[model samples]
Target: MLKELDPLLHSQLRLGVMSLLMGAESAEFTFLKEKTNATAGNLSVQLDKLSEAGYITIEKTFRGKKPLTRCRITRKGIKAFEEYVQALKGYIK
Candidate 1:
């Protein structure tokens, strides 16, 4: 049987976010939006879901006059991503 995939990370947008986070210290809302080509509303919702799961942390602050939202992956997220990759290997015949 195929190993179960992580429902949260299984999403194209969410997976993209996690993948990008894995490469950087943190990522900004607009950067993720542009890279994922996702709407602000949809990205916000997905970010909230990831935050609720404790996989990532969201920090909100004002950068000068503009609101800044940055996301950082947590240890839990790294572990989950690693496991997800391992599970995916099961699909290869």
Candidate 2:
């Protein structure tokens, strides 16, 4: 039997976010939006979902006078992403 994939990370946008975060120390909302080509509303929703699951952390602060949002994957997220990859690989074999 094939292993089950993580439904949360299964989303294209969500997976893209995770992949990007995996490579960087952190990423900003604007960068994620540009990279994923996702709308602000949609990206905010996905980020909330990931944060709710403890897969990522969202930090809100001011960059000078402008509000800035930054995202970083948690250790839990790294492990989950790795497992998700392994589970997906099971399907190809």
Candidate 3:
């Protein structure tokens, strides 16, 4: 039997975000938006999903007076992404 895939990691935006975060310490909201080519609203929604899944950590703070959002992938996210890739490889073979 095939292994079950993580639904959260399968999402395009969420996957992109995790892939990027996997490489960096953390990323700003604008950087993620540009990299993913996602709309602000869409990205925000997807981010909430990732956060709720405990796959990523979101830090909200004030940069002077404006709000700043930063994202970092959790250990669980890395493991999930790796497993997702392995599951996909099984299908390709």
Candidate 4:
């Protein structure tokens, strides 16, 4: 039997976010929106889901007068993503 995929990361948008974060310390909301080409509302919802799962951290601050939102994957998130990849490999092989 194939291992189950993580439902949260299974989402296309969520997966995309994880993939991007895997390579960076963190990412800005605008950057993610641009890279994913997702609308603000949709991206915000997905980010909230990831945050709620403790897979990622969402920080809100001000950059000179502008509100800034940055997202960073936690150690738990990295581990989960790795496990998800291993499970996917089981399906391929």
What's the CA error at residue 85 for candidate 4, in Å?
A: 0.4
Task: Give one digit per residue, the lDDT tens place, for model 1 in 1-93.
Answer: 888999999999999999999999999999999999999999999999999999999999999999999999999999999989988899765
Instruction: State the lDDT of candidate 4 residue by residue for 1-93, as single tens digits.
Output: 999999999999999999999999999999999999999999999999999999999999999999999999999999999999999999999
Tell me the whole-model lDDT of each prediction, alpha carbons only.
0.95, 0.98, 0.92, 0.97
Which clashing pairs does model 2 show? none
Ranking the candidates on TM-score from highest down gives 2, 4, 1, 3
TM-score-best of 1 and 3 = 1
lDDT of 3 by residue, 32-79 (tens): 999999999999999999999888999999999999999998988888
Ranking of all candidate structures by their lDDT, best first? 2, 4, 1, 3
On TM-score, the leading prediction is 2
Q: Give the per-residue lDDT digits (tens) of candidate 2, residues 1-93.
A: 998999999999999999999999999999999999999999999999999999999999999999999999999999999999999999888
State TM-scores per candidate: 0.96, 0.98, 0.93, 0.97
Give the clashing residue pairs of candidate 3, or none. Answer: none
Candidate 2 Cα deviation (angstroms), residue 3 = 0.7
For candidate 2, report its TM-score: 0.98
Clash count, candidate 2:
0
